[model samples]
Target: QDNAVPKQASGCVSCHSADGNPLVEGVPILSGQRSDYLEAALKAYREGRRTGGPADVMRFYTKELSDEDIKEISEWFAQN
Candidate 1:
């Protein structure tokens, strides 16, 4: 598997580190997560179906992500 970080996740590493260990206090770890769950959560944020806490931030970040981007990002983080 191509384990290089996804280009689409460039902005994500600031809060959620490349290794999936988020440095931010409230950010959740993404490493080793199920790709399907990550994709679903990202889609929920993008579609405004999820809310509360950092949902707004997540929504903003995910707003411009295409389905393919989400898939790639999800897979990237899942494998980390």
Candidate 2:
């Protein structure tokens, strides 16, 4: 498969930055984080498993992400 970094991640590049560092305050940096951790967190956010604080915003953003989207994003950020 292509695995060339999904286009869906482009939208996240702004706030999270291309390297997973957040440009805005209170946002967590995803760079170098554990892939499993990032994947679980993204799944939690998409499934409404986490709430309050940043989870609210993430929930909105991840609501439309498919399983593959979450996997690609988590893997990409982890690599950074």
Candidate 3:
């Protein structure tokens, strides 16, 4: 891991753009979304509140994130 990169930052850009737009179809666009909503959604995936299908990928990605990581990510996307 690079010392300068924020945790969880690299993982998102592949599917979700740096500006929070989803690169693929069927993926939600996170740009302009509420921070609280983003955080809650991430938390839901992390906590297994979402199930099956596309949610599986989210769960896998968010599982390693701490609460603060989620907050930072949510804020980043929300501002885009």
Candidate 4:
């Protein structure tokens, strides 16, 4: 398996931390999350279907993510 960090994770770790703990207050931990759930959430954000706190931020980030990008990112965080 390729264990190197995913390129897409750079922006995520700024707030969500590489270890899964969020560095910022109100940011949810991404580590140990379910990959399927994460993928769905990311897709929702990309589609502008998810709303609430940080929704705009998430939408911005996720908008350019392809399905494979979402899968890789979600799996990376889930396994961490």
- Runs in model 3 deviating more than 4 A are 1-6
lDDT tens per residue, model 4, 10-56: 88988898885699999899888999999999999999998877998
TM-score of 1: 0.91
Predicted candidate 3 versus true structure: per-residue lDDT over 1-80, tens digit per residue: 11233557678767876654678778888767899999999999999999999899989999999999999888877776
Worst 10 residues of 1 by lDDT: 1-10
- Please identify model 4 stretches exceeding 4 Å from their true place: none
Count of clashes in candidate 1: 0
- Candidate 1 lDDT over 1-80, as tens digits, reads 44777789988888998885698999999888899999999999999998888999999999999999999999998988
Model 2 TM-score relative to the real fold: 0.84
lDDT, candidate 2, 20-50, per-residue tens: 5589887778778898998899899999999
Score residue 49 of candidate 3 by CA lDDT.
99
lDDT score of model 3? Answer: 0.82
Which residue pairs show backbone clashes in model 3? none
- TM-score, one value per model: 0.91, 0.84, 0.85, 0.91
lDDT of 3 at 32: 73
